[model samples]
Target: MTTNDPAGDPAAARGNAARARSFGAVAAAYDAGRPTFPSEALTWILGPGRGLQVLDLGAGTGKLAAVAAELGHHVIAVDPSPEMLEVCRRRQGIDTMVGAAESIPLAHGSVDAVIVGQAFHWFDHARALPEIARVLRPNGVLGLLWNDADTVVPWVRRISQVMQGDCQTVTHSGGGDRFEPMPILEGSNLFWMIEQARFRHWQDLDRKGLRQLALSHSAVAILKETRREQVLEQIDQIYEHTARPPEPLRMPYLTDCFRAHPSEFANYRRTLDSPVAPHL
Candidate 1:
């Protein structure tokens, strides 16, 4: 069944597509404001390996792709936005391509692992999952990750509420000590042996950086001029109230990582002549 076009609210789908593409306009703020993935979190996703061909699908600004390359993997970063890919290209040791998850630009069985960072929710899973499976070699891995604010702290929780105004626009996986697995992965014939892990990390943000953080959000970036200004003003007030004298605010994040392998990897070799075995 294809999911690229679904029977749902047309307006909502259009809004989602618009929000998904909104980051390219504020690419600089996204790079500056967003926190990098923890090396340990990435290592866990890639499993025990080096020199593997890894594809960072839906990679934005190469945040996750850059870290994967540093870990000794041959990384290729792919995204739909050329503007975002431009920033990704500046980084060393990784190739950048303009592509989307629904239709990937790679050879069949070309990559050992495929990773998505904070971008899977934007994909049409029915189309993307099969495309992703097609590109993986035998026993390959697929990892999905998101970085969320640790809202267990009172101040941090308050900041989160402020950022999420009357209308919810930002999307987050999980916060604090909690991790919520995606419902899309629950019972799919395409994948199996799904596992999850979380890594704790921190980012230091000054007042200007805090504003950039707000601007980095798709909802805030697309807001009408006056309302956008109001949001920025609110962020400044929050910073003034939360900041300690002369020190940047330490923002904690819980990085949620999920990894799975194609069902074919478990019982079949993805060969045209090989008979598929049942998954046990």
Candidate 2:
């Protein structure tokens, strides 16, 4: 099975893989610090579907899976990390499994839709695209979601800079390009009818919550002990200097959501090969 590690630069990709896996070490903090998906965003992705069988691929700590379950979807949550899966299992509705995006554990043509939230960038798209297409039914939907800080707000911009170390990390992390059409999805024949939407939302967080949020990031989570402490201290200073007297400060976000359906070719192929009659 192909790993989620990035390609091209071997050393950098290995470091990224290690960084990606580092989340399990701070899984609890991740769950606590991460903001949940907006209901409107979920509604847009679901698109009038009810009780759909949905797979949450790369579902770290069940954040998006929990939201999907609440919306009455039959949710299956999958991730590579056992620690992340453990947290997911604790949630009442989701069925948790240990699996990577490139090699989903589910049977072929089973799920009505596959949703990936905040983790699609880590996927090896060459392998994962085929796997995702395999499990999705004819005309099945593929949704991608990302919760990004709205740096247009000056304080939020400054805070993001502090967390990211520099503006380049923000750009490299797809902060600016997330809302645009994804190259992998756009260039592929597997998916057609691509659509995009942005939902505005904000989270109320205190100084401690802000610290946890910073720590929840892979870049921050992978930092060495003393360096991590220094980063947190910098965040603390930023919060102290900018936040008002109110205990909970407003942190704005833009939830970028994109959805696409299987291409006509994909649907036709599935129809010809399917053991059961095509649903679409």
RMSD to the hidden true structure, all candidates: 5.0, 3.8
lDDT of 1: 0.79
lDDT of 1 at 201: 97
| Leading candidate by TM-score | 2
Top candidate by lDDT:
2
User: Cα deviation of 23 in candidate 2 (Å)?
Assistant: 0.9
Q: What local lDDT does model 1 show for residue 106?
A: 83
lDDT of 1 by residue, 1-280 (tens): 1222321346655776888888999899999888899999988988767888899999989999999999999999999999889999999999999999999998777788999998886777667877888777767889998888888887777666666665443334233223234456654476888998889999999998988888887778788889989989988998899999588899999888899888864335356523432221
On residues 1-280, what C-alpha lDDT tens digit does candidate 2 reach at each position? 1222244457655765777898999998898888889988988988766788899999999999999998899999999999888888999889988999989998778899999998887776777887888788875899999899888888887777766764243223424433233657866688988898889998999888889898888878877899889989999998998888676888888888899988877666666666533433
Prediction 1 TM-score vs. true: 0.88
Which residue pairs in model 1 clash with each other? none
